[model samples]
Target: MFFIYRLFLIILLLFTAVTTVFSQGTTKEEKRTLKKARKFLANEKYQLAQANYLKLLTLNSKDVVYNFEGGLSYYFADFEQAKSVPLFESALENSKEDTIPELCYYLARAYHINGDFEKSKEAFTHFKPFIKTSTKSGQELMKQSDYYININDNGKKQLANKNENTIIKNLGTSINSTYGEYAPVMKKNEQVLLFTSRRENGTSKKVDTDLLPYEDIYVAKQVNDNWQLITDKVELEKYIPKDLNTKKHDAGVIYSSDGNTLYTYKNDLIWKSILENGKWSNLVELDKNINSSQYNIPSVNLSKDGNTIYFTTTRKDGFGGKDIYKSSKNEEGKWNVAENLGDKINTKFDEDAPFISDDGKTIYFSSKGHDGIGGYDIYKSELTDNGWGKAENMGIPINSALDDIYLIVDEKEKNGFFASNRDGGIGGIDIYSLCINCPTKIINTINGLLVDNIETPIDGTLTTQLLSSNNPAETTQSKAGKFSFVTATTGKHQITVEAQ
Candidate 1:
């Protein structure tokens, strides 16, 4: 009986040894396959690499490296929607070490790319702590993931409350093409649409076509609701300085309320130009108070009085990677030093693309820090006498799980334009306009009957115009001394009643 027991133990030991050797051989084979797959990925042969990684997964299903590589390959091959979840899930669930955090981050990113926002949020929450110690890209991905989850929970409604059942029609051939057209900005009147385009024009020199250098800013004017190309008026090509004409990147711009001062981002700095005598003068760097040596200031918003400037900067001492900073003109006309808006407005993520309403009470901006529907969603916060209020998501149909930036609202028209790289776009990014549901209320009005040195109602001889302290150009006339106007915005205005 003792001899039989010893023989059984010896057989069991032999079986265990054989299993160990076999597992080591499989791990070696997987490492080799992963090496080959990584080589293919580096060479841009994503399809081939993906196939090998998928095969390796069958051999060693618990290999975190293999799963992560496979997820990357899937992402690069645009198979993210199909393969990302499994690769990420396998990596997260079966990882041997405490690599679950990194795995969760990747899984969240994959879910985000796959449009599974809720799942992405769950993964992100699991990954947040690890993000602080990970690579820069990992941190950025985590921030983006968190943003999408937040948008899904809080801002989903605002993003979806657009014209219901209206299939988002393409802006048509005039506004769209096989190329890219995006980041549309318009004047207060909504007649002029200034957008960025990568169309084939005379400036289509292939100096550096990898990043699409044939890009140019284009303008289209709406004449009777028909858009007509009007790039000639602005002479966009002429404004491109020799240094800024790099075929790599030269496009984002925002015109001031008066359409004279223009702020644009190019080559990691905000450049300012004035439309003097209908010609663009030399481009100059913005005030140092509004700029930083660390991060680029890509977007800017000016208050109606042009005294307060809000811009995005990646400066150190910021809340996160990027934060919004405000610089205002003091009583002496020099800009006060830049001040952070603090925790209420900024997050430990990127906050950018600010747009203050004409009334100065509502502020619209894009943030990766705030809870958003996706990549970047527009958020609005009201300015109380105390400080900025908690931001509210602009909501869906307006917001998507894609990058949405550069929002401009025409408070008078109850319509606005925003930039998106969402579905139904020409390619890359495109500008979209949708009518907003803006309810107007009547504010108390003070009226005066102008007469020619007599207490009588003047007919056709009295001229009445409304003027505001903030906007000098926003003037509307009322004839015959009987002026009626709706106060859609809240501000101080003077009604001048005079005899002409």
Candidate 2:
């Protein structure tokens, strides 16, 4: 009996020692989890980190760090409504005096994100001085608060003004509101409009989640002046690799005249897609001759023949911001080296949204670099034998103080269309039309070296007739024996040269 009692005592002592060690290990794990949660929050992974922090809170209910981190996580996750009144309130209620200012700052941010402007202002007012004199983050928070206050005041006025008829309509319940819709490209027919949107129920929605709304290219046909959806929405996310599928932002697209070729801008690279058998093929990145790792291609325009490409980039040695550049296709069907349009066309400010005329003789673009009414204005320059001539403003009725972009012209119809966010539109931005009013007056001049068919120099009299249809408007003879005519309206005119 003595031996058995001694053995039992030894077993009891060993069990007690093991329990103590396990309890100590549990304490160490809680500490480690708390530290890791804080690190994740700092890196902006609020959701994952917040879950861990909340678990820690259950184990240690009075922990101030858990309350603070949980509130921040909710705020970053955009669940500001849930966080603002509860998580923030709890943190402020329990925070020590030394942490009051930080707690108040976070509470204000939560309120701000929740759209509770008045409450946010009150909290910021109390927290500003402490942040200014204390931490670096505090200083930044104060600056940010001041910026938000100003933005709020200005944004209200801007929003109110934007409701006027002069503003573009919000595309209403049909084309927008359900999703993020932007980057519209309209054909000259105006019957078909192509745009990009992040809408639901798209193919590859899972993969597209990395880009949110899964920004896809959508086409809508105009029926009775209203846009009607057609074709299955296409998401470019599948073309992207898993490692490059960013949850951030991507998308800007332009198509060739025939719509057989497509150029897309995503993740700082330019990709090309070919239309085959009525379907778009897999996208391939453009050759290095046109694309660079230094900067991204934001916009692009292709000439009528598809042999010339104009694009915008912020590569080094550029004028400023993003500059317009041109590259031509060689005989091998590869892009030649890119060439800047030079200082005449580019300025120390941003110049983008380039469109070459169908005739390929005139180029239209928007620029903040040139002296403008305000923001960006549309400008055009004709291609001369010596290169591009001086740019000319399209003038007041066409240009505005607000952003004007995506200029298009139909040479055959002599009509132009451009997008603007100016004082008149459906909302955001609206397309406008401008007519080319051809002049009526005609001028004729005849000047050329007088040479016979046999290449012999001879004195000659050149007679030119300015004709429209069957009737001749004017008949003129060249005094210097050379021929040239300038007609107000474009038409077939007859000319006759006789040597004397």
| TM-scores of the candidates in the order shown | 0.60, 0.48
lDDT for each residue of candidate 2 in 76-176, tens digit (9 for 90 to 100): 54222234346678766665555545567667655654435566667877766654335555455557667555533432334343312121122333454
User: TM-score: which candidate is best?
Assistant: 1
| 241-308 per-residue lDDT for model 1 (tens digits) | 33434454556677777777777676677787887766677789877777667667766778887888
Off by over 4 Å in 1: 1-74, 77-111, 118-173, 176-181, 197-215, 223-228, 231-248, 438-500
lDDT of 1: 0.62
- Clashing residue pair totals per candidate (backbone < 3 A): 10, 18
For candidate 1, the per-residue lDDT at 252 reads: 66
| lDDT, residue 488, candidate 2 | 40
Off by over 4 Å in 2: 1-182, 187-190, 197-215, 231-250, 413-417, 424-427, 430-500
